[model samples]
Target: MIALPPELLGQLGTGLWHVFAVFLRVSAVVTLLPAFGERSIPVRVKLAVAVAFTLIVLPAVPSPQSNPGLLPLARLVGTEVLIGMVLGIGLRLFVLALQTAGSIAAQSTSLSQLLGGAAADPAPALGMFLTLAGLALAVLMGLHIRVAEFLIHSYAMFPMGQTLSAPDLSQWGVRQIAHSFGLAFALATPFVIASLIYNLALGVINRAMPQLMVAFVGAPAITFAGLFLLFAGAPLILSIWADALFSFTLNPLDSGR
Candidate 1:
């Protein structure tokens, strides 16, 4: 049997440890990242993606020597997971923004409660359509590559084996939650306005013709209008969302700053 040099073996061990740390963080983040982390994807495929990304980011990530005891190592791994979750949860907010926008749009147009929550979330058919379309669009635009780059750059903001601040993380989380809801309401504003006008028109028409069966006429009109609005505004909506996602990917800390 041939024996390897101690130096080479030590180097290999260090490299493997760094790779493992990267894998922990990558896997955690990938489990929640947007298109890659969607319910439609298989766990094996996601794990494969995490491995691929770990390989790419290994060179850029710094490996600090630490106490290799079991308890200490476990704590480091847990910290990595927490960092990954914070980064991932930031992007996840954008997905929720889309969901909220869809819900509002569906409700305003009376298109709610029609599909009975076909998707994972309790969203209307319109919401489901918009979300699926948005996700597909994001994937087509090379979301994985953007995410990999984001991970590589994240080291600057969140270093490995570093202690995280609870107050800072909490503040960031609150800001992200507020922004998500704001974006959602902004995206759905147009639909809400149209619905308002639509309802007002229906009220006047019904007042003029009490027994004319306004439900029959108003329902179809709002439905058709909702579909048209979706068709027309979807591109703009997705464009805005993609811009925000891409921007955040490149500079994850800018939102907080």
Candidate 2:
């Protein structure tokens, strides 16, 4: 049997502890990340992803204090988990923005009930489509690389074993939520405008020909228009959403974005 020296054993333990500490944070973040964190993804795959991120982030971050006491270790766990959740929730808001935009667009185009249960979550068909497309686009654009950097940068903003200022965090959360709603509204603007025009023209036609059943005549027209607009405007809408998402990833606290 090969007997390892006490010094080497101590070093090994500390190193493992450091990795565990980092994993705690990484796993929390991965639970709510965009493409990689979707509900459809397997739990094992997510665990592997968290490990991969921990390895990627390990070298960049400073090592945790070696051999902490039970109380200190528990404190560290809580702190790291909370920080990870805050960062993860921030990123998740962008996904919420897409979902919100999808709901608005779907309702505006009168397509809300079509395939509403397509996704794991109970959302409108358009919402499901946009969410899936946005996730794919985000992945294609090297979301993993940006997320690694984001995780590394998080260490700077939220240092090890320190509690964040609750007031500041709360304020920041509110800002992110407000921005998400605004972004959702902006993305759905085209559909909303089209709905408005359809309503006005329908009103005029109804007035002009009281004998004609305008609802029956216009239902198909509005549905066709919605489909056409989705096909035509999707590219632009996704582009705008992607830009906002990337911007948020780059700087979560940027209120102006």
Candidate 3:
């Protein structure tokens, strides 16, 4: 191979730092996305995914201004990391919608207490279902393509070295939290209605026969009915949820900075 000229070598060295910044930014987002972010995924797999994303994205990302000094390089890296984190966290909020729905469904069905133990994530049974559903839907929807598009658009909205404002972060967080609650309620509505009718009927039985152990009789019946309702309603709910998640993940203005 022919040797690169000294001037060309200098230019290459200067551009390398910019490439590193892009890699950091892209990797950060990949490391936080659902399937890749989960603790179940091996670190090696996550790293590989991140690396692949970085390579693909680097060409599209605008190069950072060349900074010869170490401090500027450090600052560039930090800015990229921050941008990545914000993007990741924003997308992660959609997952919370599922968790919230699951928790609501469990509580409404009176199955919350019966759940074996606290999940590592400290979610209720409904929340667990929601999480699994959302994750599965994300995987099925081809998350990698959506995420790449999101990242590309993000660069246009919140380019490198531009720190997100605190107020912007606060607003985004609050909006996401509210959306999570709303999505959960929407997902659990059918179950909630079924649960209400079941409980009201159980209450009537208790009043009619005070001597009978209504709680024992009602619990098993409700559990079986709830399972059936879940199976029947799950497909529609998951479909709606997948559509919502796709919209949220792809929304260019989601960052709202």
Candidate 4:
């Protein structure tokens, strides 16, 4: 083998270190990413995706420190993992929001038991459908491209080897959770309104015609209304959800918004 120059070897080592550092964060994020990190996906596939993201993000980010001592290296590992987890969980929460909205809608319409276990997450069929559609829509709308930009931007928000402030992180986490629930409620508002109207009408009919079994008569009406609303309103609900998800990916660190 031809001998390599000392400078060339040193540069190679530095490059490898940078790649490794980036990989740590990328792998952590991929482990909890929305559709790409679903439990149903094979582990090998996830690894390939993480590696691909690392390569895409590497050039855009500032190079990490090379040749760190053992203690500093350990700290770097922990810091990167923590940041990646925070970011990944932020994206995952949007998926959870969609699930929550679907559950609420199903429960309101008395359709909660309709194939509830069909999905891997043990959610109602409605929830599973919404999640699958939302994920597919997100992917079709260039989710991968947005994710790459998000990953590169993250390096600026949480620099290499820097630890996050606990109090700030906690507050941010609270805000994100609140926002997620708020979004879910917003998406399920139509179902709730329909349920309320149905209940009121059922009560009036029962009082007006006590001889008639209002429950039997009202069930079909509510079911039909629920299905129709889903068919008509799904597009709007998904559009709202997609906007929120994209907004979050664009500025994950700004949880206050």
Candidate 5:
């Protein structure tokens, strides 16, 4: 057995602890974020991923001084975890855009009540479609690579043991929440316009035939029409969504910008 010197042993211990801190932060983010972080994924799987990612990122993270005390170590770990959660939640906000758009589209088409397969949370059929589409688009657009780059850059932006002001974090969080809605509206714009036109025509038809069961008759027509519109406009919508996601993931500060 090769016995290491006390100094080398101390350095190795510090490095390992730092890596653990990074893992905790990343794991917290993935636990709550969208897609891979969804509740549907097993806890064990997430833990495994976090460990894997931490190993990958350890070489990139700067080394910290050896400290055996629990308080300092706890604080350092907390900061890393907070930063990780913030980044993860920021990416999650982009996914919310698609869900919001889907909800609006569903309501417009009178398909809001339709049961969709469980995704994230139990959502409507339209929401499910939108979520899947957004996820697939993000993956296709190299989200994983961009996310890794972002994680590496984050250490530079917010270094270990630095205090992050609560006010600033709150402001950033609020902006992300607002941006989620804005992105959703942008994605659903085409469907919104289509719904308006369809509703207008329905209104006129009802006026012309007062005895007609407009609700029952128009439901099927609107559902079919909405499906058709979704099919036709999906490509454009997905492209735009992917671009927005890429931009968001690359620039965390862009939520406010």
Candidate 6:
């Protein structure tokens, strides 16, 4: 059996503790991250991904307090977990924005009930499409690297083991949420406007041609227009969403974005 010296043992224990603390934070983030945290993914796979991320980030995190006792370490773990949750929730807003946009667009275009089973969550069909597209685009654009950098940058804004400021965090959370909703509306605006025009024109036609079955004629017309609008507008909508997500990833603290 190999025997370790006292000083080496202490150092090894501290190192392990630091890694474990980081693991807690990473694990919390992985539980709610966009692609990795999808409902379709197994919890075991998520745990492995979190551990892998912790290993990658462990070397970058600062060391733990000197000779910390059990209680302090436990509190530290709790703090790290909270921080991870906060950050994960903040980033999750991007996906929420996409979902919101999809729901709005789908409703506007009267496609809300079609393909409703496509999403992991119970959302409208357009929401599912936008979420899937946005997530796929993010992954294609190297979301994992950006997420790692976001985590590393978070340590600077919020050192581990420190109490997170409630007021500031709340304000930021609210602002981010409002911005997310704005993004959703912005993405879906084109569809909404098109819907308004179609409805207005249909109303005029129905008034002028009351003898004709306008409801039957307009339903197919609106549906066809919705499909065509989606075909033409999806790329642009996804591109705008991706830009906002990248901006948020690169600079979460920048409210100007």
- CA lDDT, every model vs. true structure: 0.86, 0.90, 0.78, 0.92, 0.78, 0.86
lDDT of 6 by residue, 165-196 (tens): 89978888889999999999999998899889
TM-score of 6: 0.94
lDDT, candidate 4, residue 232?
98
Among residues 3 or more apart in sequence or in different chains, the pairs in candidate 4 whose N, CA or C atoms overlap within 3 Å are: none
Would you estimate the TM-scores of all the predictions? 0.93, 0.97, 0.88, 0.97, 0.91, 0.94
Using TM-score as the yardstick, the better of models 2 and 3 is 2
lDDT tens digits, residue span 42-94, model 1: 99999888899899988998886733998878888889999999889999988
Off by more than 4 A, model 6: none
Tell how far residue 108 is off in model 3, in angstroms: 2.3
Q: Is candidate 3 or candidate 4 better by TM-score?
A: 4
Model 5 vs. true fold: TM: 0.91
Every model's Cα RMSD, please?
1.8, 1.2, 2.7, 1.1, 2.0, 1.5
Q: List the residue pairs that clash in candidate 2.
A: none
Which candidate order results from sorting by TM-score in descending order? Answer: 4, 2, 6, 1, 5, 3
Q: Which residue pairs clash in candidate 6?
A: none
Per residue, candidate 2 scores C-alpha lDDT tens digits across 105-216 of 9898889999988777789988988898999998998899999999898888788888889998888988889988999999999899999999999999999999999989
Please identify model 4 stretches exceeding 4 Å from their true place: none
Model 4 lDDT tens row, 92-159 = 99999999999999999988999988876679877888999999999999999999999999988888
Give lDDT: candidate 5, residue 172.
90
